[model samples]
Target: MDAVSERLAEVHGGIARALKDAARTDAAQLVAVSKTFDADAIRPLIAAGQRHFGENRVSEAADKWPALTAETPGIVLHLVGQLQSNKAEAAVRLFDVIHSVDRPSLVTALGKAMVASGRRPDCYIQVNIGAEDQKGGCAIADLPALLAQARDAGLPVIGLMCVPPADVEPAPYFALLAKLARDHALAGLSMGMSSDYPTAVLLGATVVRVGSALFGGRG
Candidate 1:
């Protein structure tokens, strides 16, 4: 196997081990974060049976994915980034899953966009789990209203997504997200990254967005 395939295998192994420890039979889908990497870098993982991939920018994904998806069918593109309300139409058309539906304005934009395009991508309400000032997630205090508005707007919100405070233990934050999802009756917990995905799986993440671990560090 090539290097990327080897890394993909290792990450899958880690997920498998974590699943066993969590006593959960269902598997957490790995959305390989292919944000900065181009199609040449991503093809190996796709060849290795990876169908789900994530990108941080709508424009970037638009630039790269159309041809790639044309060549290789069954690719699920995830937008795991802060989306601009203005770009909602493009995002709705491009991404298969959106993991950053965080505000009322965005919800409204996405709603209109989905209607115009006839595509309703599954969404995850991003919660600012750490209450950080610089982050893009909706404040925890506003999640219920946001979720209600999203549902009202006809957005198919599947779960919660979060990025914890950078250097601390992420378990607590992951646990909090999982609890919030349960309280809201949301099942998809789109959390975790390269550093702490195993913990995320154990704590109840249905989708893990991993980048560097699979594609190696970006310059």
Candidate 2:
């Protein structure tokens, strides 16, 4: 096996063991962040039973989606980047779940795209828990409005997604997301990455996006 394949095996085993120890029957879903990598790098890992994957760019994901799906049937695709309004159609067609529904305009665009495509996709409301201006998530105060918007648009509100600030500990952020999910009565929590997944898992993260840990550093 290649290095990526080997790393994926190790990571999967670690996640499984972590789940067992945590007594989490779901043990946090691992959406391999396959943003920078391509089919060649991901195929082996998929062949080794790693299915769910995430991507950041609509254009890149559009290119990779079909080939990857053909190579590994039943794989779930997630969009984990800042989704632009213009790319909403492609996002709906390509991703099974969108983890970056942060803005009202974007949500409306997605709803329109779903109407045109005749398919309503699952989604998560991204929360800017860190209050970072440079980020693409909604301010925490705007979540209820956003969630209501998504619900009214016929989209299935899966849960909350966020990228905690660089310096802050992720447990609190993950914990906050869990609380928010409980408050909102949503089922999924898409938080954490390679660096903070353990913390995220501990704090009840249902979905964790890990990239470099599975496929190594991006170029």
Candidate 3:
């Protein structure tokens, strides 16, 4: 097998093991994050049967995905980075799922954009699980209000997404996100990356955003 295919297989194996250990019959969706990489790098994963992919920027996704999606059937694109309020319309048009709905203003923008474009992409409220200043998730304290705003605006808020502080044990953060989702009656938990996805699965992540494990280090 080629390098990408080998890596993909390894990731699938890891996910399977995690699921078995969790004793959960439901499958966790793996969103292969294809942010900086080009289409050439992505096609191999798609050919290897990866349907859900994530991009970081709206413009970059627009630049690449139109042609790629037209050629491949059943591709679900996710915006897994912070979205600009101004680009909501374009983002709404391009992506199938958005994992960074973090604030009231952004929620409002996305809601309006969805109305204008007639496309409602699945949304996950990003939580600042680590309370980091640089990250793009909503503060834990503000989650309820933001969620309420998102729901009122008619955005299809499905779950919660989080990126824990780097270089720390991520299990607690993942567990916390899962708890928050449960508290809000949300079923989806979009957490974990290449480093701690198996732990995340054990803690109850319905969707894991994996990038480097599948694509290798970004250039």
The best candidate by lDDT is: 1
Model 2 misplaced stretches (Cα beyond 4 Å): none
Q: Where does model 1 exceed 4 Å of error?
A: none
* Backbone clashes, candidate 1: 0
Residue 35 lDDT in model 1? 87
User: Per-residue lDDT of 1-219 in model 3, one digit per residue for the tens?
Assistant: 988889999998998999999999998999999999999989999999999999999999999999899999899999999999999999999999999999888999999999999999999999999999999999999999999999999999999999999999999999999999999999999998999999999899999989999998988
Winner by TM-score between candidate 3 and candidate 2: 3
Best by TM-score: 1
Of 2 and 3, the candidate ahead on lDDT is 3
Report the C-alpha lDDT of model 1 over 1-219, residue by residue, as the tens digit: 878789999999999999999999998999999988888988899989999999999999999999999999999999999999999999999999999999899999999999999999999999999999999999999999999999999999999999999999999999999999999999999999999999999999999999999998997
The residue-by-residue lDDT of candidate 2 on 1-219, one tens digit each, is: 777678877766766766776788876788999888878888877877888999999999888779768866799998999999999998998889999999889989999999999867789999998889999899989999999998998887888999999977777788888998999999899987888777777777888899989888889
TM-score ranking from best candidate downward: 1, 3, 2
Indicate the TM-score of model 2: 0.93
Q: Give the backbone clash total of model 2.
A: 0
Q: Tell me how far the alpha carbon of residue 136 in candidate 3 is from the true structure, in angstroms, after superposition.
A: 0.8
